[model samples]
Target: MTRTELQTLPERAVELLGGEPDDTTLRRYLHGLAGVDAVGLGQRAADLGTRSIKTTSKAWALDRIIELIDLTTLEGADTPGKVRSLVAKALNPDASDPTCPRVAAVCVYGDMVPHAVAALGAAHGDPDDGGVSVAAVATAFPSGRASLAIKLADTAEAVAAGADEIDMVIDRGAFLAGRYGQVFDQIAQVKQACRRADGSYASLKVILETGELTTYDNVKRASWLAILAGGDFIKTSTGKVQPAATLPVTLLMLEVVRDWHAATGEKIGVKPAGGIRTSKDAIKYLVTVAETVGEEWLQPHLFRFGASSLLNDVLLQRQKLRTGHYTGADYVTID
Candidate 1:
């Protein structure tokens, strides 16, 4: 599709969802989503995890996984210097090998968006040149305990600062308390706030923090809620919570996106963030995507890994594949 046609996707999805649903309608839509069978879901994910990938296939997986990495750093000690370094790393993950592909994006806290944008511009010369995007975590990230006003302001600040993407955490307390409409409204408002002063809007990734949601059924519900509320992507975690992204959680999310596409004909993205630290683990998630959703979802636009260490591991594996010998940690740059 052309750029004009692609830009109209969000408008079409919003129209299909009825332009801001009411509480009753939202609750009905939430209730209508089918529940997932925990046992069956776990069994299938485990079986997929066992699939063997080697040699040439492993090389292909490494390249694709490199492109899908968000290259994240969400710490209390983040600084402009740190963000610049991260941006440089994202632009050239493996400087020794020029053929190495750049990462999908560099993710940081909201206040660091501009630093990332500036750094990326210095590296690539144009902010929209499309070498790599800058993603900011907003909406009271990780905890999601703040008020909606503060959350929306946070989102706006990130987008106004030139973030290409916004990763917002959902209000888990409201969701677990059975306030589905409240959660839906919050996501919708955040989605709206992503619109910049110019007519353009950053892509929105709604993080469910699945570890705290406590059940597969809740993950399914949260997935549908985020998609219906205009989230371009549904993410698995904040990486702060203990049990961040798991095969089963990500698998179920893939199923949710697959089903949503089947119903609406609008494709949504899936990001399995947090705790996915190895190239092997990253490949398993890719395998899950290919087997469960189809190879179409394997691209960065449709899939992502919200990870920092994952890039290093993928680079190390790439080097090993190139030389037929494993390289030491000193070979790759430390984040």
Candidate 2:
């Protein structure tokens, strides 16, 4: 969709809120949101995490987890060689084992999109084989503190360089300061910038940095705000924060997506990024998704894990499942 198509968003927001919402009106809507029961939410997540999956189910889950991974590398020291190596790992996660599935996408910084695109084409012979997508983090990335022009330029450059997906960060400062209109307008503008020259737009993943939001209520408000503002996926964090992507936080976002779909019939994706390192940890997230949202969300398009080391752990577990024994770290290539 184009910016012209979304010009009526303010009207839509007014309708959604039952009237035109000024800043005070927006705050009232946000404050009127139901309070989260932290204790109950944590208990539910913990209980769901304990539901055991046997060998067969676990094997199935391992493959699904592989497909759901973004296979990310967003470090300051990122080089083209590092991106090429990561792209190779993304294309063939387990080289010795062809049965293992490729990851959903290769995530990198905006500047690295061209490198990743070239590497993917060289490795796979066709960059658009649907084997993997190149995701670029834009809009000032982990910190959305830059001007809108720079942010839009960041997104447009990544798109022009052939990033299939754009992971843009929300201005937490604006949101926290109660500038809801500013936050919503920035997201809408970035969504517009995601539109490629070919008329097909890249999928936009809005990172809320939930850890910085400071409350489950803010998380809920941010989820709704992003979805309503045209985010294809509402992400947990940028992974730079200390407490990125916790289970309780992810569970709250899942509930937001579920309820949003029920109300609007629009199915927005969810990504739980950062600090998720083990296959066991990934499986608990899967369980929460299955029980909270439903089986329909098990696909890669609807769910994703935004982690670098998590891929290796998942591959190792898949190898163990295939060979009936644990494999050493040397077996699976590091990301």
Candidate 3:
């Protein structure tokens, strides 16, 4: 349905539903949403994001998200060969030579984008290559702690060096202290800096470190704030915090995405990063989206996992099903 059609929905379902969604009701709702009235319900939840009203399901969606994981890390280990090997391992954990389920991306620090770019460029030589794109963690990376001048410079550098996408962390201190303008302004500038070499822009994924925020309401608030401030995607955690991207936090974020899309007539993506580590975990996340947002969000564009070890498990599981027995650990590489 169009955004205009979403105009009459209640402004805040959390308040209407009385005290927000609890775990049991939320899980039942998310899990059972598929064949029921979720389109209208999900649309309502999605609309809340437009109203800047925070609404979240009671059960944390992390467990479900863990099942649809994206194994990721930003380090490149200091060399091109290492970079290529990492990508290779993620692509072909069983040494299948040239095929594997596409990983979300091979996340790398800004300086390493050149190495990743060169490697990916060569891999693209073969049309069927499963090479992952280079996703640079920019805007001063995990901390979001830097001068705007330096942050923008860092973002530009990552893109200039050929980052396929850019993940910029919002200034947590600013956002936490209610300095939404500063945080939003920084994200906007960084997005601008991430323009493609051809003058287009790399997709912008904003990281909202949920652990730093004191409550679920704040997490929801941060989610909309990022979107309104121009984030193409809203992500959980920087993997530097104690609670880094949990099920509850992810559920809250998903609700934010759903609500935002319902209200603005704009589609935004969701990425749950940090700590996901298995195929079962990844699939559950897929289920959550399918249940919470519907099948339209099943594609990589709207949904993804940010993980590193999770791919190895996904490969192992696929291999196990393809063959008839368990594969030895040596054939797969998580490190």
Task: Using TM-score, give the best candidate's number.
Answer: 2
In model 2, the Cα lDDT at residue 273 comes to 97
TM-score of each: 0.89, 0.90, 0.73
The pairs that clash in candidate 1 are: none
Assess each prediction's global lDDT (C-alpha) against the native.
0.83, 0.84, 0.62
Count backbone clashes in candidate 2: 0
Candidate 3 lDDT, tens digit per residue, 1-335?
Answer: 32121212223323322333343332333333222233554554344322210132211222223233344556535566777776665444556734444454677788877866676665522112434566778877788888999988888888888776788999888766666657756776777787666666677889998888776666776776676556778899778786876655666677777876775556777888877776544554555566566657755556778877776666656666456674433221111
How do the candidates rank by lDDT, highest first? 2, 1, 3
Question: Considering summed lDDT, which 10 consecutive residues are worst modelled in model 1?
Answer: 326-335
Clashes of 3: 26
Can you rank all candidates by TM-score, best first?
A: 2, 1, 3
Question: Candidate 1 clash total?
Answer: 0
lDDT of 1 by residue, 1-335 (tens): 11223345456545655654655665666677677888999999988876644323666778888888899989999999999999889988999999988888899999999899899884532223447888999998889989999999999999999888899999999888888778877887898898888777788999999999998888998998888777889999999997899999999999988887877677888999999888778877887887887887877778999998989888988999799896433222211
Residue pairs with backbone overlap in model 2: none
Error of 1 at 117 (Å): 0.8
lDDT of 2 by residue, 185-243 (tens): 78889998998897877888999999899988899999988876778899999999968
RMSD of 2: 4.5
